[model samples]
Target: EAKASYWRQLAMDEIRRRSEYQPNTRRARNIIFFLGDGMGISTVTAGRIYRGQRRDGSSGEEGCLSWDRFPHVSLHKTYGLDAQTSDSANTATAYLCGVKANVKTIGVDSRIKAGQCHTDKSTHVSSIMAWAQTEGLWTGLVTTTSVTHASPAGTYAHVGHRGWEGYVPNNCMVNDTKDSARQLVEESPGNEFRVILGGGRMNFINNTENDEEGLKGNRRDGRNLIEQWMKSKEGKSNASYIWSKEQLLSVDPSTTNYLLGLLGSTRLPFVMEQDKNCSSYPTLREMTEVAIKILQRGPKGFVLFVEGGLIDYAHHANRAAFALEETVGMDDAVISAMKLVDTKESLILVSADHSHAFTIGGKPERGKDILGIGGYSTDGYPITTLSYANGPGYNETKVNYTDAETTDPNFVQKATFRRYLATHGGEDIATYAIGPWSHLFSGVQDQTYIPYAISYAACFGQFAGSNCHTCKTSTG
Candidate 1:
């Protein structure tokens, strides 16, 4: 009963705090959108436990991650125009471009189908980045995936096929349209971005050319886009192009007006796989800090999109440990931004494109390692606390437990199906918000409601005409 007073007092304080709460209605001068790719509610819950365990070696069930502390939260359905479950491509169109497109399409309306090429600009739907620029707000994007990947590409590219990032195959023939790499370097909002960071250098360079690490690119077109991006920024801006961790962190945001860092040839290595002391790429948190430092220098304010894209990649491989770790890494980035930006006039949004077919079942007890075995199957064989609904892990029937290393990083949790890769889940995802207009984020919403809500919060797009003249900024 000694702890009852402590819990009661905490509850009373929280009640008092909520009872006197006033929503911040001030015009948002800055907006930061954080997308945790394929981060479902399950991922967040498990990630919270994993984070607490890793940090304090405790039971890790009671604590919350950084964004979990946000004042407003909502659950949003994540379905594409054609598919019940969504991929990053189509969903990116909704969340970033504010329009739902067909599966595997990006930045175009539902008129564009996946794997098809179109020459029409009429079907194109512009992203918030473009809208932010229309109002002269500085814009940028950072991701663990290549900057040209689905979510980032949604901010700029209007391609019909997501796989056409590097090259357009003969059958898929993207000859009529620009590939995502070309779009980033040659397009309007993309070329004007002050900061761009991530992997997938192969899509930006010629197949004959080698990246900084001697990795050959995959682009059949002989054009070297990285050099072209540099040339575009020459004299016009104090642009810094870097390809290593040391170079990225060394960049002085005060001196550099434009930044581009392609740290990997494809998607970045999963966080757990990177050597902390010698890895050449910065963590998502490090990239976020540098991006913010540079982006916040705008006179008209800025909007930045930082994506933890590798979380999806880890889940697809049925690596629950890595997926949860990536989520925690993203939480670190969110925590860093919270300290760097003033929440009174700045709006920070955290959301996901979709979810993976993963589960955290088996009813393990308190303080147990999240990745450890939770219970035994009907046959008396051990099963893990984390397993996918479907994945490559079901290649064989299980009869062993004594020789198993359930906690190993390479451990692929069991799956029900024998697919080559896991699939996305057809379920609702959550969005958490803080700062200006954050209260509007509560309740169930469609996935496309995200960009519109952000626009409303920041007073851009249709809401640019919005005024907060009577609203006073909160000091507390």
Candidate 2:
């Protein structure tokens, strides 16, 4: 219980803070889009509370996340053009390309269908990264998931199927369509990128080849695309390719204009599972800051896409602790970006592709351990505060976690129904923004509005207006 003075003072402080806040009116020269895959409003609330508890053992419910200070906030519908509940591919296409696409499709419009091998090339859609690059702006991407994964793939790859990342079917897709990794190496926006940092190097190397870690490659096309990417940069720019954390930090951002960092064979290990082997893996914060340091050198500024993609993975696996930690990890990158960039000249947008069936309920008291049990069930079994709608944790009988180590990374929370993996939730996601034109993001808008609003602020795509900089319009 709190007193009247406490409530009044808290309200006054918040009101005073709001009154003093003023948005920057100038058009943004730099655009940084941060995507937290599967991070819904529930995830945000849990992560904020979890972070607060971890930081100071506070009640956590009243605390704010790093991005909570952003002056503009909104809610957006997350359904795809063809899906009542969307996956990463379609949702990424919506936010990144400003087009609602079918599930399992990336960088293409509704004219493309899932698993369709061949389609008219005109159906291909371009993302903000392309629009920025065509305007002579530096472009880059960073993520904790595979660079070939659906979220990042939307920025570069135009494939009928996201699984085409490493292997294009031998079927009749016009016989010469390259895989996603090859596109990143040899094609448009991806090739023109100033920085590329993420996992999935197995897709880049030949099946016969091995990386420095002795991990076998997955590419059956016999192309070492990493080497090809390096060769393509020959005599064009001071490009450097790295496969380890030490290599990433050793390269000087002042001299290296193009950087490709493949940090993991697949997705990077979860934070809790990371072996103090800092030399092997790089945090999302490290990759983002490094990318910003190099990309910020451009005279015309830059557009960067940074993703905390593993949150979705953890949620599907029914690991609530890891999901919440990954959410906070994204906020860590946001905090770093806020410190590194000039908000007056940079527009920072933080949002999610969709949500999970994860929930945080049960009248757990204030300061209760977020990962611990909430209360006992009527049957006399203790249940955790966190649970899922459907996942591997489901059983005919509820399992008791009363004496279990709920904090363990391997611990899976209970679910109401059985599913090998949980599915995405069909719900609106919260969107946060700041910098110029961020107010346009207020209120409920379609997910496709993300790139549109960004384009308006950065002066690219269809919103470039009459005095456009590019000879040809890249997108709108």
Candidate 3:
């Protein structure tokens, strides 16, 4: 018994030490921030239980690697300066720049005059990625969404509103035409980020043009950002541009200092839709691995932002099964990242930008079926084991419906939709960090401080307040 106690103490000591472990000042070389877009505690909890049920016969313990394994964990308030239920643009701006800005604004605070309305200017501010790039550190941005989408765009681009895409600009005068979506993706090139990956081919394509097949489809920007990017000095000598999985794996990492990979014209296929012969697409994990390999080649330490950006979309569609699978895929990406970089010298932070209104509540039998049996009852009624609070095509009655039965085709579980009163936990979202200044994240913290916390950890807190003061001791 005494020997067993000694081993347990040793394990506890090791865990505690891991939490407090600081990186060597001289050797520390990289910072990787992984954002799970809408992963709330319940979302993560449901994911764990789902994976556990699939693996072993029982729902695993509350503590799992994604939740329990990080050295330090904290909660974050996700409200934007203007709204309560935040969007990715504002939340991402806060995470990337450390300030609470107006909703739909990217990479800027809400003080600038944007045409008629008082909106933030993307030019006045600097993003962490920009800072890293200025310091000569190689940076990479990867997401399942468009490269210019909110989260990914926050890493580098700055704009008054996130909706600059889709709509045609009202004014076409030379000076007034700058706000057009086409120019937003390419022509405006001050903050040219080294590594760019993801979808949004539509933004780059011209409105009228035909491809080799003579199909008069929208040709990506006549400028051809992909071709220009590939032919540039960075793309030609230091980087390899790949639009498919085959090109991604075949590229020589040692010689490639930069890589431009866009798997799909839109968001990449969800995990369920992807398979081994997914030659045209790359999984989140695969992109992460390749990004790390290339970024590490830089002499200065690098900053890489990877997003499981699709989780939120699944929740929006009320597809819990798809959301859970995406979360698992995110976990796989985290594991792959940890494998390549040593915790001793790297700072790794895993967190969410905001959360979904999803929850897990159903008393399924201990070893019972996942797709429950015996006419499942919540309070007391025939219902499916899974449900959503509020979303499109939602209905409290019928408990089961098909596309033909519902008004919306995007609806996942139409009939099973019992409108439970859903709410985001007033409790801040969870944050996990390892290595260097991870200690800063212990206990509950405001959401806006995350970027500062990361910057401090990566640079040993040296550049804490130079420009990014939103995360300093005052904010905390």
lDDT of each: 0.89, 0.88, 0.66
Model 1 over residues 252-341: C-alpha lDDT tens digits?
Answer: 999789898899999888999999788877899999999999988999899999999989999998999899999999999999999999
Regions of model 2 farther than 4 Å from truth: 277-279, 465-476
Model 1 bad stretches (over 4 Å):
1-7, 171-175, 402-404, 466-476
Off by over 4 Å in 3: 1-28, 55-58, 112-123, 166-168, 172-192, 210-222, 234-236, 276-279, 367-379, 383-385, 400-427, 460-476
lDDT of 3 by residue, 1-476 (tens): 24898879978998898777664433236888998878888777767766676555565433265535776788888887777877888788888878887777776676732332322243445668766666667788888877767787777656666755433234422233332234333432323455667765555445575322233323333545555555554424665667677777787767876667766666787776667564467888888888888888878788889999888877777766677778888888899999999878788888898887665555655544333322445555544344556765376454543223221323364323443323333336888887667767787767878877777655533363354333444543
Q: Rank the candidates by lDDT, best first.
A: 1, 2, 3
TM-score of 3: 0.81
What TM-score, over all chains together, does every model reach? 0.95, 0.95, 0.81
lDDT of model 2, residue 358: 88
TM-score of 1: 0.95
Better of 2 and 3 by TM-score: 2
RMSD of each: 2.9, 3.3, 5.8
Top-lDDT candidate index:
1
**Taking the tens digit of each residue's C-alpha lDDT, what string does model 2 give over 130-172?**
9888677999999999999999998998998889888888884
